[model samples]
Target: EKEVNSMIGRNPDFARRVAIDFSDNLASAKMLIPIPDDFPIMAGEILRVNTGLDIHLDANRRPVVALVGVSLMGVPIPNAWLGNMK
Candidate 1:
């Protein structure tokens, strides 16, 4: 079974309200968000959305996590696009 990090402060990119549901158990997950307000907007509209977060444990007693990392969000209005269109 895999488990998420309990130390919230350790990974500051996760949201405290977030929780990851794995098979039988639920693991605590947080997004250490750097720019909270802009995240939703910057992530592009055509980009893939993360359904959930998962943590993988290694045999060496190390933990690896996978998260939905996107560079863009939502489509800008036609008027807004015009502003950038030169």
Candidate 2:
């Protein structure tokens, strides 16, 4: 974060904030964040995530697998898998 902070110092006014979002062909989830927009957009200004395979047990105790991945402009970003529980 230090690197970004340094960049932010360069532009103290024009830049406003940074944001990250997740989207699929059919839907999108967006999170707007307040950040030093002065931070230079890195060489690769895109982010993406890969969710290779998912395994889960259904109510009947059967395992299921699904092909999954995430992308910001088709590039993969890093992410952690979250489990769903009732």
Candidate 3:
């Protein structure tokens, strides 16, 4: 977590860009985030999207696991898994 915070501090522009991209994608209902090969797990943890795992087949017919439905900007939104359960 500390490392990721440091990285964010060092690369504010990249972080801001990512936040904007995440917001845009969310607004468009495109929730599948393409995990970068070099993305840090700690960073993902910081974003709080480290849970929702889904299996998808890649172009080579290989199974790939990825996180889905997790927020990017830490917005206070309802859980995507559980619909309005007032």
TM-score of each: 0.25, 0.24, 0.23
Candidate closest to the true structure, highest TM-score? 1
lDDT of 1 by residue, 1-86 (tens): 23453553356554253444455222332223334444666443233222333456768978755442222233223433434332
What tens digits encode model 3's per-residue C-alpha lDDT throughout 1-86? 35544565577655543322223112212132445557766333334332244555779999775444444555545576546421
Worst 10 residues of 2 by lDDT: 24-33
Q: Give the runs in model 1 whose Cα sits over 4 Å from its true position.
A: 1-20, 24-50, 68-86
Clashes of 1: 15
- For residues 1-86, what per-residue lDDT tens digits would candidate 2 score against the true structure? 35544565476552233322233322222322333546566333433332344446768988765535444545555445332321
Clashes of each: 15, 5, 0
Q: Which stretches of model 3 miss by more than 4 angstroms?
A: 18-65, 70-86
Model 3 lDDT vs. the true structure? 0.44
Report the Cα lDDT for candidate 1. Answer: 0.39
lDDT of candidate 3 at residue 7, scale 0 to 100:
68
